[model samples]
Target chain A: MFMFNSLVENNLKIISKLKKSLARPDLGAITGTILVFLFFILVARDTGMFSLEGTMNWGIVSSQFIIIAVGACLLMIAGEFDLSVGSMIGFAGIVIAVTSVVWGWPIWLSIIIAFILSMLLGALIGFIVIKTNLPSFIVSLAFLYILRGLTIFGSIHSTQKTIIGGINEVSKGDWLAPLFGGKIFTGLFTWFAEQGWIDVFEFGTRAGQPIVDGIPMMIVWAVVLVIFAHFLLNYTRFGNWIFASGGDAKAARYVGVPVDKIKILMFVFTAFCATVFATCQVIEFGSASADRGVLKEFEAIISVVIGGALLTGGYGSVIGATFGAIIFGVVQQGLFFIGVESSLFRVFLGIILLLSVIFNAHIRKIIIGKG
Target chain B: METPIMQLTDIGKHFCSIKALSNVSIKIIQGECHCLLGDNGAGKSTFIKIMSGVHQPTSGQIYFSGEMTTIESPRSAIDSGIATVYQDLAMIPLMSVMRNFWLGRELVKNIGPFKIMDTKKCNAILMQEMEKMGISLHDPSQSVGTLSGGEKQSVAIARAVYFGAKVLILDEPTSALGVYQTEKVLKTIAKVREKGIAVVFISHNVNHALEVGDKFTVLCRGKTLGTAVRGKIDYAQLQYMMSGEKLN
Candidate 1:
């Protein structure tokens, strides 16, 4: 009888400890990502996605989603949303292309100007939302159109067409272009290929091009941003303010938190991130289009939600959002490799988002032990 | 006699055409729980808001420590060391105790351009402050949502006191608590009183008011019915005054 009692006590302790650990908001995102990864690996082990080149392709795409999702996560943690992120990408792309290619401005200078303009627009949106007491959804939805219209209009005005080409041409010989767009570690890959470490292409080299190319600049940017955002959110005073502002703004204000300022800075950071994604794409793709990054705002928000961020605000992690982006990229490219149509990716996104909300709610209820 | 920390003289408030408050005055002193007793909409809320600087009186003067000063805004009141813990307690339920305690005024370590939170110090101070209020927390990292209602109130009280509040205003802090929690909160109030800080406790429960209050002021229809001392007034008399009845 005493032995049974001790066994029951030990089980209770384990259960309690498990419950406490699960209270962390990021647990759902982490577990969901692992399940999804295992599901794909089991079903598509023979597909090209298992290959290095195929993995790199999805990683590059996921990088774009993660760059913006990190920003969306921070803004969501601060209790706001920015639907204009997708449009900001297009607008910033047009601004850089027009300034550098059409107006003969230096590539670096054009990028800086576009960045400043995006931040100013962000500040303006934050100001209107705070001063007029309007929901950010309504405000950013308005900006979505304003920015999209300006992008298309500006492209036409500058280049006399909807698309601005020759950015790669303008970027040639510019010292700053390669850092933002070009692939790095090419020499290392070439050496590895020569040493027979990686299999060469059966079709042989095209004009002596190495089979294993270096990593894309976009991937580097995404990684650096994810780490930086994680640090800021988890280890900084501003991170506490974000959680406080989102949790309960009135309570936060009662404690003397600069709720408005934290929110405004979050908006600005979101815009800046969108601009970074645009910069990399404009330089890498060697052109800019007014419709580039269409519907990307929805994609980023979906990733953040999947990463365990609360829509009501005040709880989330950047690492979770990064994993969410990975889940998206894997499913998107994996579907194609499995011969499934890519349009169904949206259905997957919608379902994942809905399920994540439900899962997060359940976890919170368990941790809080209340309805 | 010691000068009152805050004194409102003949305060009246008019919201458009309706008179929310009229001819109400109260003096709060150091190291005392001055109970403000009233039923719902008896101008207790209006009186508290005025004291907290949420609303400026349309017809009266406010004196702080014998100085004629007007509290123009909530910011001014907080800056002057006047903290108000509303019925809701003004706490972020989703945040951890340490984060919630240091929400607005978080301590930071400057590392170049970045300012990181000093979590160790924050958690230590939070634990110490909460313990001094006679509430021992197992882990400061636990979310405030997991705490009981009365514990949450104690946290809010402790937070206000930690921020150098000279006058602490609590609005119906024990209304939602159970019998045990109510007892705990009442004890916490006594602990706060010993720190030489003035407390303006608003409650509809005559028993609760009688327990911790050194002086009790009853309000009826936006006016002061009467003020009574603890030993001088009996429970029946205090209850009658709260019910808006004349002793005679």
Candidate 2:
């Protein structure tokens, strides 16, 4: 009887715990992830979207979003926005391509230079916002136009065209290039193909190559970044400072928190992530386009919002943002698989974003009201 | 008699033509609560800022432990064992109680070459410290926003005491609390005083001040009306001192 009573008490505790967990900000993203995967699995299952190669395709697409989403997630939690993220991507890619191809510099040197310059621009924006007391949204919006204009004009002036090619050939054997542009586990995939588990090319120039070679570095970076950022925000002192800096800058300052420094560093990190994305894209495409990554900034913010971060700042999770990116990637590819118009992707995003926001507001109210 | 722990002499502040504080003098003693009472626009906050190093007095001399010094920033103030709990409490509502307890000074455990917050030690310490102050938390992982107004005040006070605060300055700690919550905070202040820490309580509430304060310094138009000890002053006298300083 005593043992039975203890079991009943444990069950009651878990029920109360479950009720409290429902108010977590990340609930929206977890729920969204489930619904997205379920809808796609039912509709696109027979289209081979779940196959190894097809999954890889959508997973890479998700990684592309995850890269930018992670940076935006941290900065938004620290109470700022970087509208220049898309433009920064285009600008950083142009810098790499022009410096490496047009200026005849080494691929490794060009990559380092592009990263440094983009980060410096990010620091400049942070300084301006802090010094002038201007809103980051407006300041970054200005940089959005400025960086985009610079990318187009600089590309046309240096190469006489908006598209610069030959980076693939230049970065082919560079020491640092593989970090941004390669696959892992090719041998494992080959073995899987040998076991007749994965599809293999039967009639190509060189046969027996698995269709899904290995996990791309892009996905690896996404997963690593998600884990690293989640740990940083949860188990580090710097994480608390970020939240405090966003929650109440004045109060934080009174308690000896360096709010200015935290904000500036977040800006630099955002630019660094943008450059990483740009580098990967340039290597994969073998060229850099002036208009590449247009509207990516909005997509990243949408992902963060769907992940349950308030636009007002100071509450979010990197894992939730990752799920939001996965939802985006799956829906983008799944609609194509199920033979739906691609334009419905945007419509779906709008509806989902609206619903997520409403759901998040409800959760927030519950949290603020009682539990 | 013991020399005051912190002494501010004729401190004055001005923003161009408008003077926020003209002439305010006070001496904070160790192991006692010094109440700086005033009405709205009574320069109470400005005086707290000056004492807490948020602002530099345009004209005055600050003496600490009988040695003249200058407090140019909040960081220097904290380094000198002075911590301020503003009306807003300097807490992140979304963060856990343990995180907020050690916001700027997190206890970290080193692993290899990296440093991360020690969750176990922090959770234990937070619960122990809060319970010592008469508030037992269910868990350290609870969000601070879920706490009552008075409980938040106690947390700030507990944090200050834990961090080796020799002088704890509280701004309007009980102005926003209910009767029961205010009683809890007053008791906490008394408990802090017992630990031999000097407390500068800034408030507009006369009854709250009279309850926990040993010394009362009334301010009117950025100037001190006078300073009186608890046995020599009553509630009506202190209330009258602030009533005449009302700004319309």
Candidate 3:
């Protein structure tokens, strides 16, 4: 009888511990990320998806996604939506290109002006949403269309076509271009090449060139943003307010938290991040098209949701969203490297999003029941 | 009277032509649980809102710590050491107990240029305050939704006391709680009173109020019926007064 009692007690303890761990919102996202990464690494081994060069290719793409996803994750945790982010990216890129190329403005000055204008528009959206108390989904959805239309109109007005080019040429002599968009760690890569640590084509015109030359600026920006956001969400009082405002605005307000202010700041931050991504991409690609960044807002929201942030708001981790972006980057690049149809990528995204929602809901139910 | 901590005199409120509260007066003394009893629509909510600075009374005078003061906003009221624990307790259920304990006025330590929340200090203070309320939580990091309804109330009360509130207003704290939870909340209120803070307890249940209140003020139809000390008025008289009747 004593043995039976001990066994039951031990089982109860184990169950309680598991419940405690699962109660954390990030657990689902972490599990999803691991499973996806392992699946890709296993299936695409022959495609060199695990190679340094392959990693670099996906890393660059994922970093761009992470920049906006981190901001969207924060905003979601504050209980708002920013469907305008994708359109804002396109709009910001056009603004940067038009000012620098069409108007002969300095690239650095155009970048600054574009960022400030995007932030102002973001603040306006936040103010209107707060004042009107309308659902943010509806508010941002309207902005999505408005900004996209404006981008197209502005591009036609400036370049006469949907595409605007020569931004790379325009930024040739600019001092900030190298810092914002070019490669870094070239010296380290060169040392690695000298030591024969990097892969090289055995017998081709590109035989002497190392496959992994240097780390791109995009990856660096993404890493910096991840670290910065993690600290902001976990260590700051503003972070607490974000959770509080998203969790229960009414309750937060009663406790003297500036719920409205936190939410407005979140909206503005999301816009600023969209601009950051636009700036980086414009510098790297040397042009902007009105159609660029199409449907990116949905991708960002999906990344945030997969990162364990609830659609209803009030629980998420920047680290988890970073993993979510990694998952997206892996799948996107893995398919191309493995000779799968590129269009099938969207199908994978849809499935992952659906599965994440179901898994998160199941985990929440268990935690709530046990709690 | 040792100078009542807060005094509301002839407080009146009107919503257009509708009178929500009128000529309501109450004096709250330190170390006392002054029960403000009223039936539904008896102006209890309006009176508390006015006291908490949610609304401005059309005609009234408020005295705080022996001086005339105007509570222009909820933030100002909190700054002036007035804390209100609403029916919902104003707590985020998903947040940890420690986080909820220091939601608005979180303690921060500056590291470099970043002002980060001092989780260590928040956790320690939360545990200490909760223990003083005669409730021992196994883990301060546990989400508050896991706590019993009575425990949530205790956390709210303990948070208010920890913040050095001179006047704590509780709005129907036990209305949704079970009988056992209600008992626990009443005990917490007594403990808070022992700390020498004036408590404004709003409730309709005279029995619950009598269990912890030192004095009682009954409101009916936007008017103050009367006030009585614990020993002076029995439960029968309090119930009758609450039911819109008066004794000769």
Per-residue lDDT of model 3, residues A169-232, tens digit only: 8898788876667889888887887789987667788676677778888888888888988898
Q: Which model scores highest in TM-score?
A: 3
Model 1 chain A: ten consecutive residues of lowest lDDT? A203-212
lDDT of 3 by residue, B1-248 (tens): 37899999999999999999889989999999999998998999999999999999999899999899899988899999999999885578777888889988899998888789999998888888888899989888888777888888889999989888999999999999999999999999998999899999999998899999999999999998878989999888988888888654
Per-residue lDDT tens digits for candidate 1, residues A222-272, read: 999999999988888878888988888887776677899999999999999
In candidate 3, the residue pairs with backbone N, CA or C atoms under 3 Å apart (3 or more residues apart, or in different chains) clash, namely none
Query: Which candidate number has the best DockQ?
Result: 3
Candidates ranked by TM-score, best first? 3, 2, 1
Candidate 2, residues B1-248: lDDT per residue as tens digits? 89999999989999788899987889989999999998899899888888778889999999988899999888899999888987675566777788889888899999988799999999899889988999878778777877888888999999999999999999999999999999999999999999999999999999999899999999987889878999898887888888864321
Candidate chain B TM-scores, in order? 0.97, 0.96, 0.97
Q: Report per-candidate DockQ.
A: 0.63, 0.63, 0.67
Q: All models: lDDT?
A: 0.88, 0.88, 0.88
Residue B73 in candidate 3 has what lDDT? Answer: 86
